[model samples]
Target: MPILQWLTRDEDTRAVRSVPYRLLQEESALSCGDPDAANMLIHGDNLDALKALLPFYAGRVKCIYIDPPYNTRSAFEHYDDNLEHSKWLAMMWPRLELLRDLLAEDGSIWVSIDDNEVHYLKVIMDEVFGRKNFTSTIVWQKRIGPDSRAILGAAHDYIVVYSKNLEAFKATANKIPLREDQIAEFQNPDNDPRGPWTSSSNFSAQGFRKNQMYKIVTPGGAEYYPPEGRCWVTIESEYFRLLKEGRMWFGRDGRGMPRKKTYLKEREGQATWSWWSNSEVGHTQESKKEIIALFGASNTFDTPKPERLIQRILHIATNPGELVLDSFLGSGTTAAVAHKMGRHYIGIEMGDHAVTHCAPRLQKVIEGEQGGISKSVNWQGGGGFRFYRLGPPVFDEDGHVREDIRFPTLAAHVWFSETNAPWKGKGKSPFLGHHDGKGYALLYNGILGDRRPDGGNVLTRSTLQIIREAAAKKAPTFDGPLTIYGEQSRLGPTTLARENITFKQTPYDVRARR
Candidate 1:
């Protein structure tokens, strides 16, 4: 595989690992509608938010759509869109690595970008996601009128798509729904019982084939052969079979070259094309109007994406109830679309607009605002999302576990560090659940609340008795070694080794990573 190197490539490549895991602090007051919703809108640096999400959402997201800054060198009120080439690569490298980890095996990622850094973005994406998984680059007509600034006006942008595993995506990738114009093309001219149908050219552009160059005699006794340089699409036997089945069509006079009738009943959907027109999806002006309508003209974000564009993406890439994440939650179009389409979503943003623009608009969505894509998706809208902020880093800048870290938070971190699995059990005493034949236990924040020297957070004869009782109830026949993390332990190394136990002292073992 090839790699794109920049000024800070080596440093930025390993940046995600060095990033400290931070707990997501939910703000009940900031969240709207329901408190137990699956969707989330996080306010913080997106890189930190993505890192925070990994312990819970790794390998679980069904789709991810991000519209990062285009590096167009223009200033916007909400963000700095301009960066030097190496700095831009430095910024994008780590986020891509984390996003790749969050995708399910059959999932895909779509990124919207313009010409300024698209070539570089492709090279880096090829490096991050394997080149074998690269899907086609869709050309979106974003504008209608030409700009007079340059010799040739720019009117389009690119959407580079890649699948986590191309083979898996191929098995379940969806077809596009037929547009009104496309449905109108199917007409029941013959009034056949098979329903409305459309006529398509039946000749192949390929050269002569053995059985494809056949002769057909029409009802008027006119002999027709394949055109001057074309051949029949199939062998004569199949053509005659379809003709007998009434799937073949001739002109009203029944003397023209034969064509094939494709019935609407036989179509599941239309295959998506690489070129997307503005009339089909949407354009920049429409997207801005939607923002103005939602925010009431005073609080518009820069370069908001059209909801129709995201709706199209969701229709093709995901199903209802699947998880979708947008780390760069600029104007929150992705989350709104995902919500309206009945898929769960997580949106992360650094700017304060996450509260002002993203959260407020979502509240309107829950109240049944019939704006962008609402009518199309039939969104009567009663679902909700939780709002979160990135808390202080779990390990502080000096690499020490913070004194304020709670038991559940520490247990989550420990389970992730030990097994790299999501913790599903209630954070309780004696047992933290088992994975890969090893049982984990955390005794932090004085789980038993004795506060004495031989408390629950300490490993003693009493603590061992509690552990044994809990394990017998949780895993009765388990004989695997128990890895216990605690504040202190009174058991000797000889006794600990004999009992098939390994005790790691907390705050000491945890802080060593820093």
Candidate 2:
């Protein structure tokens, strides 16, 4: 596949790998409602927050929705929304990488963007998510009126959808419910025993099969043949069967072209299409009013999306209790919608509004305030979310691992680095976890009660023996090679080779510089 290359392509390509892992510090005092709820509202730079979430959430999220900065050069009260082209691409590439990792194999991601960067974003996403996974570019009408500044008014934006695996997503995808007007189209005109019905064409233009060109006789004894270049959609035998069962329809005169009577009882809903109108979903004005109602102010956020829009997305992408995430929390519309819809959510934002705008709005949701999508989703409200702040960087300016880092945190990092999988173990011992038929172990934070950097943190004969015994107790049948990451290794190459051990020095070997 051809790639989208920009000035900072090389630098941005390596950016996600170079992002230093950070710790999440929960602020229990600011958290509201129940503590057992799995929802989270994280206040920090989103890039770092995404990295912090990987250890526990990778491959667990069912849906992700993000409304990133459009790079429109328009200044807002909270977001800059302005950056050089290359700079914007650099900022976005790494975040996309982390989001892709957090997505489950059967999950999908929806991104909202406008014309200024939509084309570029598509090319970049095609590279990140495989081109085969590209789903559709939905045109969302964001305005009821037109813009007078340009020769042609721009009234719509787009939401691009991509699935982690196209085949897997197809198995679970649902259809959109029929609109009132669509339901009106089906009526019981002939008073048939089968309820309301609609007519569908019964002819094909290809005329590929000779048996599909047979004649038809109407109830009034009128004869008919296939049109000039068309053939019947079914074979003669099947057409006779449908005719005998009263499933075939002719015009009111009883001599018109044959049609199939589609009954309403067999219909679940309509398949989704690419066009979404403001009248059906929402518009910019409605979105602004929603933000005002939640925050009790105007201009708090210039580009907040409407909760109904997110609700529509959640309706198709998620189910009750599934994990949903939004990295650009903005006015917190995505989280609010997810909560009301009964989905667990994790929202990340950098601005002060994460506290001032996002958290307080959720508190109202827990209190059963009917606003935005509450009435739509029938949310009487009873759930909670914890609030957190980003802690110090995992690595210092001098490229040394922070001394205050805990064993579990370091273990999560080492497991991710060596196996490229989220660390799900509790780090009960030096043995972190096993993946791809290999056992990974980490020696940090003096798990052996020796605090010296080169003492308990080093891989020596005794450390190896301890890990072997622990591995036997936990993963008894495991015979894979052991890869250990530590402060240092005292054992020589001969011993390492003979024991099937691979050692990586800590700090420099694991720290991410960017």
Candidate 3:
């Protein structure tokens, strides 16, 4: 496999490791509607924000769509759309790595780009996400008309898609819904009792098979044989079975070649193709108009994606109530679409427009403002989202856990460090959760209802009993090797070994894992 190399390739590849995990500090005042909604809108650099989310959302997102700066070598009001080629690659490398870690095994990611750096982006994406997982590139016609000033009008942008695991993604992949024109193709020509249907001319396949070369006599008593270098789609016995079931068509006159009748009621959906026209999804001008409506034309977002484009992505890549993520949230089109379509989402944006553009747009969405795809999806919205900003890092300069870290925050980190998976702990007990046959407990910040020296932070005989009692309440039958993190342990090494217990001192063991 070929790898894309740049001046800072080595450092860029290792950048994710150097990114410190920060805390997501929620702004309650900025939040809207339901306070407990899983939807989040964060204001921070996406690299730090993604790293911060790993402890709680690793391998949980069903779909991720990112529209980063295109590096188009042109000035934009919102983003620095120009960058040195290698610097742009350097910036994207670590972010992609973190996004890959955040994606579920059966999940997929879609990235929007243009001719500026799409080929380079593809090469790096092929490296980060395995080349084998590369799905088709969708050529979205972003422009409805030709560019009068350019020699060759660039009318399309590429959406590069990749799945975490190709086979797993395919098992849950959805099909595109049939358009009105496609549905119009089906008609009840003969008034069949079953339903409206269209005839398929592929009754004969392009292959020579001995069993599939039998004759077929239509209802009109006209016999037909397989054409030259072709064979019937099925053997004689199967053909007769279908004919008895009225699944074959012989044209209105009943003397034409045999065809297969596919009923409209039986069709699931249309298979998605690589090309997408502006009529199917929307054009850049349409997207610009949507932004203008949301935030007045004076404060329009420069590179906002059409809500229908994101709608089409969510329709194919996810089901209702599934989780979606967009690190480069831009004008929050992905979040708005995901919300209207009933999917949980986390959108992260770096600029102040996260407060101005994205949040305001979503607020209108909650109010059921019928713009963009709102009318199409019947979006009478009644959900909410929390607003957050990147806070202090979990660890300090000397590599010790921050004193201000709360139990829930440290618990998430502890669980993730112990299991290499996202933490699902509810922060109600000292026992975080069980994973891979090992039970984990954290005795920090008075989790055991006592903050004395030997009360909760230290693992004494009494505190150990309380921990066991809490663990039993959660998982009564979970009697396995116990890994507990506390300040100190009173039990001797021999006693700890005999009890199948591993005691790790906090701030030391946790930092070591990092």
lDDT of each: 0.86, 0.86, 0.90
Summing lDDT over every window of 10 consecutive residues in candidate 3, give the lowest-scoring window.
Answer: 505-514
Which pairs, if any, clash in model 1? none
lDDT, candidate 2, 452-490, per-residue tens: 744678888888888898888779999888898888898
- After superposition, which runs of candidate 3 have C-alpha atoms over 4 Å from their true positions? 512-514
lDDT of 1 by residue, 7-52 (tens): 8888999998788788899998889986666999999998989888
Model 1 residue runs over 4 Å out of place are 203-246, 250-260, 396-403, 424-443, 446-482, 487-503, 510-514
lDDT of each residue in 419-493, candidate 3, tens digit only: 889998785689887998999999898776666877788988888888889989999999899999998899999
**Model 2 Cα displacement at 292 (Å)?**
1.4
TM-score of each: 0.87, 0.85, 0.98
Per-candidate total of colliding backbone pairs: 0, 0, 0
| Model 2 ranges with Cα > 4 A deviation | 1-5, 148-151, 189-195, 203-205, 218-220, 237-247, 250-256, 396-403, 426-432, 441-514
Q: Which run of 10 residues does model 2 get worst, by summed lDDT?
A: 201-210
User: Model 1, residue 348: displacement in angstroms?
Assistant: 1.1
> Among these predicted structures, which one has the highest TM-score?
3
Q: Higher-lDDT candidate among 1 and 3?
A: 3
TM-score quality measure for candidate 2: 0.85
Give per-residue lDDT, candidate 2, residue 434. 80
